[model samples]
Target: MNTADKPNPAQPHSLSANDMNDKLSGDPISNVLLARWIMRTHFEQFAGSSVADIARAYIGVYSNRPTSWQAVLARNHNMDKSEALRAEDDPELVRIPGMRRSKFLIPKSMANMVFGATCLPLLDHEWRLREAELTLEDYLRIRPELIRFASGSPVRLEEIKSFLGLSGSQARACTTVATYNGVLVRAPSPNPWSNRWLYAAAPSELMHSHDALVDHEQLQWELACHYIEQYGPVSVEDLAWWMGISKKLARLFLEKAGAGEIESGLWLGPLQKKTFESWATNVSESSDERVRFLPNWDPLLMGYSPGSRHRSCLGLDQIGAYDHAGNGLPVVLIGSKAVTTWRVTAKGSQRLLSIHLPDDILQKDQQIIQEAAVMWAERIGAIYIP
Candidate 1:
């Protein structure tokens, strides 16, 4: 990779490496970078914490599936899947369409801000209907009936479709519209791995909060700042891609949020500077070598600009851990650098866990990797295959 594409301050793109090295001599830039993100994501920051606690820290937990969300909670709080995966019972959490119009599990308290920022526009202007013959007028007309159907109890999507006497594209379109307008929400799936979910009327409080119609510009700016707080030291391109907005709009939001350029291209929000300093100091003080097994579509892997994703992969840029569509696959991290990839597959009544490692890895490092892999497998009732 070109030096310009790298996020490491030790290997400056313009200034001589020595000059950049000197500039960050007091505290190593690499350490600061890793520490800042780890702290921000709250990776292993606590033990035995509830799902609601961790949900509050992130803007949204990408709901690829219940298993993916479980992996996030398991890794963050150092708990078993049994505990982490069962948080579907948490009343404070709810699923809604978030960035890029994708489903996300977020705190109910954040419903107004997130829905206004990402989904509200879809209600009238940009209906994401796939093939339904329904118009916006039809959607608005059906919204109340859908909410009334879902008001009494959580209803499965299929059940909602049956009651509406809609099928295929029509059912999908109506449900999508209802969800974006906060008339419906995704309830927990019946099983951890199922793609299907129960739909329910959104909480009355959440609906009322959004009905107030917070100023659009203010909501966007607030969401941008929230992203920076959770994933800062980012660029305009990163913010744009993450929020699925135009670069011009992203720049405007950053400016409005008082984001200062921390480097040539990277910026940090004014509100996060103190927290960033504390994280850097704490990381520098401990600086321990720890290993983390990250799950597919983890935010850390998906949070950066395409050009700057090397920040997390470091020497393993060619690992091809992400699919062509930019969705992250499961990975293994030593500190912030993803050194390898891993996966588990069903084998008879058991699951086989496999780790892809460089042939030249040192024996000690190999042993450490094995130990971590074994612990991860046992946590999920899988058998590690060395």
Candidate 2:
């Protein structure tokens, strides 16, 4: 085996590195290259770092998506010392002290708010009338209420609620920081997917009183980069599917990164060309994919939902748990494919993980797969320790 093929010492690609850089035309901003740039731009901050921890940052910062309390903490705790995953780690979050699970969500209100704050890392949000669904700019241009400062003056929760016509429960949810303890109400008109929240750095991001900070375009750019860089060699359809956005917006954003034309039907932006070299050599090695066990909301699973070009990649197994009606379970990742199924059972001190790998896997693959499973379970603080 080649030295690089040994156990992926470097941080795993946040998305699908297997296919990030491919041929394209007209514009250099092909989905493959853009996704690689996303991963390369962001994960480089934590290169060779723990894949799980890095994933947390990508989901919170780049994706700008709100996460469930359970989801955020689990990812944080996937590493051995989850309790220590964050200074705020707690027993409830961790399966064991310092061991927890993490979930993430990206809300609509915060998306625009994050863009306005200039706190998001890169990319700019171009406000178009159609995009925001507001034909009259001035009508939607109302500024945030004038906030006065006075010594010993505390923030009146009700005042904020009255401004937005929110209920007491909704107010509590907005105040929730790291651990999701409240239910932020969904916006009724412009954005109905509102109210929901995802994970973020507690002290730094979530605490910000404003909603716009969550969906800022820089974060979106970062997310776009993650999808392409990590899951590149992909297509526009994949990004559209993963993000739940329209293809027009996806193409528009990809083009913004200065993509350039390559061959007659191919385009390669500066970043895309750069990505081509990084994984060019790795392709042959990846030709024969392996069996991987991915938790629910896996990047691949979540990326290609309906309205996506590669909609089928996620498969039924990864989504069953996320059914709008009930709690979803983890999925069995087979190479780039989402195949088979799995469930975790906790009998007091021990957690039993039963995985049903794809029937298609060969005996040789199965043997190798079991090894990865042990490694994965132990990594996520599985009580049975594989």
Candidate 3:
């Protein structure tokens, strides 16, 4: 009696392409959210000593200020009423307010984020402002002292130039680039700060690679990766438009990344226009009419264009921008389209989430929106009763 072991005779042999996609992205949070996860946990995780916190504090100072390493030394003196910057002048320096140490050394403590880690620098800079008494607007003005950034605090992304070690035309160029990447503001020169505010720090984290460092490359790569990962069995051209890459570069990059079509002989996006092809066969016909609550800078809104750049995958009408300054509303995506908008408001200790729908929302879909709003509130830890 020869008994052969069959391949898991009780279970199905293999999953189809659709099944595989569903498994990976069942509760899919787009690539943008995934990037945040990588920033906090992988690329810029606080692995080293308290030195990481030090680096973060100085990163904010240098990126937005005009002072030099030497000037910083002088400022240290001025801060201590000059005379001298003895080790103990601040033996009680108290770790720059960003930390709780009373005997922290400025230079040694400021190394974790200065080297290679990208987000570390940003996290530190933002936190430092939390300790300041100025408003973001005051910090960026000609006189930070006059601005009252302390109405409760310092300006964050808008004043990133206070960090770099650059000057002249190069400084201006850096300011522009930083602004584009979501750095709030850029100053031409520095005053009490320093002139090192022109260049960019490492972006969110160690982005994917290659073009990731380049201007639009990382965003482009992200767009492509997102499309394929979420809606694969698609084409390269479909990705290119979503990514805003040149057709030629898009093709080259896709090929370089070693992506292949499960279906042969055709691509989408930039290449499809020339060859007349589509990735229809790979998509699932049954898409949920679920209303997803998304942030203002959500990946789809940022990447996809109304032009023929991308396939009309989602029907978004009037994409609403969520205010970073204000507690914003969640954009309502009915099915795969952005139909209307809604937001939750807080009055005193009570909170209210509101929605404005265009078409008649079904009883079930409305329930989804309501539950989603509740979940959103819970994530933000609001004390809403109903």
lDDT of 1 by residue, 60-116 (tens): 777667445554654454555666677756777888887877777788888778878
lDDT of 1: 0.67
Write one digit per residue (lDDT tens) for candidate 2, span 71-181.
Answer: 333233232334323422321111100001123333332322222322321111122322433232321232123122101222344554565454655433333311221
What TM-score does prediction 3 earn?
0.36
lDDT of 3 by residue, 1-386 (tens): 00101111221112245543532344322322222222222112332313223223333222212111212221121222122223212221211211111111234233222121222223333333334432334324422221232123333333433433323333343333223323322222322222333222222332222233544444444435434433332445544554444678767766655555433423323333222222222433333333344433233333333332221333343444334432223465543455556554557655555667445655655555566555544433343243
Lowest lDDT block of 10, candidate 2: 91-100
Who is ahead in lDDT, 1 or 3? Answer: 1
Off by over 4 Å in 3: 1-238, 241-243, 256-291, 307-313, 317-329, 333-339, 344-352, 382-386
Please give the CA lDDT of all the candidate structures: 0.67, 0.38, 0.34
**Highest TM-score scorer:** 1
TM-score of each: 0.82, 0.48, 0.36
What TM-score would candidate 1 get against the native? 0.82
Best by lDDT: 1
Residue 385, candidate 1: C-alpha displacement in angstroms: 4.0
Q: What CA RMSD would you report for each candidate?
A: 6.3, 11.6, 18.0
Query: Any runs in candidate 1 off by more than 4 Å, and if so which?
Result: 1-49, 123-130, 207-213, 278-286, 309-316, 346-352, 358-364
